[model samples]
Target chain A: GIQVEQSPPDLILQEGANSTLRCNFSDSVNNLQWFHQNPWGQLINLFYIPSGTKQNGRLSATTVATERYSLLYISSSQTTDSGVYFCAVIPFQGGSEKLVFGKGMKLTVNP
Target chain B: DAGVTQSPTHLIKTRGQHVTLRCSPISGHKSVSWYQQVLGQGPQFIFQYYEKEERGRGNFPDRFSARQFPNYSSELNVNALLLGDSALYLCASSLSVGTDTQYFGPGTRLTVL
Candidate 1:
């Protein structure tokens, strides 16, 4: 079983601010992704970066697999971005292919 | 295209009862997985099905079960539900099994009394 840990469990920022969320895994992962759980409880995929960096709009993510850590960056935050940001990962071995999710970073962007 | 769709967005049941939650994956998807997310917690995996076969299961109890249909749709059935069973049950679908990126439905909010 793999263990996932997310930092800044709770975060609050003013609109237009930037923040960085980090996720550290206990083992190597073949796949890693960042998800946004909106207010409606729908989990939206943010980034699917197993390694290197990816940017989508104002959101970006980078995964350093060798270091067993990943980061999600939210730039120019908006009210709509307020929600729980989660990091999920699957190990290289196909033990279950089930995602091991971190507790999540609750982000609140004040308008 | 339609994303993952779940039936009965909300539900309420009593303890010791049986309940079933349904999920229809996106078209052309062959893998469906079930997860339970409690209040203030992240989603926990329950089961994973691919090509109408059980591919993997989580650390949940035997009372929890699920199956995938030929069309890749899936159902999660819980027998002898407990108060602890009250949680938002989420169904996710991916192009294939063992993929980390998943598209999740809105989820069914189950409240047990």
Candidate 2:
């Protein structure tokens, strides 16, 4: 079983500010993904990055497989970005794809 | 194209009763997985089915079971429910069984009385 830990369990940022979130996993993972769970309980997939770095508009993510950690960057945050961000990982065991989710980083962007 | 669709947005059941939740995966998706999300916690994996066969299961008790159909649709069955079993049941579908991104449905909110 793999353990995923998310840092800054809670965060508050100004609308135009920037923030970074981190996720550390205990073991090697076959896959890693970032999800945004809005206040309405909708889980939206943000990125599916197992290695390397990816950017989607104002948000970006980088995963260093060797270090077993990932970082999510949000630049010029907006109020709509206020929600819980979660990072999920699948361990490299028998091709198991069951995601081990971290507690999540709760972000609040205020106007 | 439709994403994963779940039946009955919400459900209420009594203790010792049986409840069944249904899920229809996205078109062309061959993998279906079930999870339970409790308040203030992340979704916990329950079962994973691929090509109509059980591929993996979580730490949940045997009272919780599921199966996939030939068309890749799935159903989750929980017997002898308890108050602790009340949570949001989420069904997710991926392109394949392993190491793929899962698209989740709106989920079925179940409350056991």
Candidate 3:
């Protein structure tokens, strides 16, 4: 089994500030995804970066598969960003394609 | 296009009771996976079904089971539920079985008494 660990389990920032979340896994992965869990418990897809870097609006993510880690960056955050951010990966082991998720990082953006 | 959809947004049950949760995947998607997330914890994988067949299962007990239908819809059943079973059950669907992005539903909040 693979292990996923997220850093800075709890984060609080001002509405206009920027932040970065990190995720480290114990094994090689074939797929990696970042999600924003809203207060209503909806897992909103943020990015699907197995490797390399990608950006969407004020959010961007970079994954260094060789290093078994990934980073998610939020620029000029908003109040709506107050929620839990999760990183999940599908390890390249066995025949199973199940995603092993990190404990998640709780982000609080105060206006 | 509609994303993954789950039924009974919330549920309450007693210990030893049996419960079933339903999910319909996005159109053209043939893989459905189930995950359980406890309070203050990350979501844990339960089962993965592809093409109406069981492809992968997590470390959950035998009380947890799931099946996918011909239409790619899925049902997750838990027998003799325990208090520990109370959590948010999420259903995710991907276009294929391996190395694809999984889109999740809003999830069903289950409470066991």
Error of 2 at B14 (Å): 1.8
Off by over 4 Å in 1: none
- The predicted structure with the larger DockQ, 2 or 3, is 3
Off by over 4 Å in 3: none
Q: By descending DockQ, how would the candidates be arranged?
A: 3, 1, 2
Q: Model 1 chain B — which ten-residue stretch has the worst lDDT?
A: B94-103
lDDT of 3 by residue, B1-113 (tens): 99899999999999999999999999999999999999999999999999999999999999998999999999999999999999999999999977999999999999999
lDDT per residue (tens digit) for residues B1-113 in model 2? 98899998899999999999999999999999999989888889999999998988999999999999999999999999999999999999999966788898989999999
Candidate 1: tens digits of C-alpha lDDT, residues A69-104? 999999999999999999999888856588889999
**Predicted complex 3: CAPRI docking category:** high
TM-score for chain A in each prediction: 0.97, 0.97, 0.98
Q: What is the TM-score of each candidate's chain B when compared with the real chain B?
A: 0.97, 0.98, 0.99
Candidate 3: C-alpha lDDT: 0.96
Clashing pairs in 1: none
Every candidate's DockQ is: 0.80, 0.69, 0.89
Backbone clashes in model 3, listed as residue pairs: none
TM-score-superior candidate, 2 or 3:
3
Query: Best-fitting candidate, measured by DockQ?
Result: 3
- Positional deviation of B97 in candidate 1, in angstroms? 1.3
Interface alpha-carbon RMSD, every candidate: 1.3, 1.1, 0.6
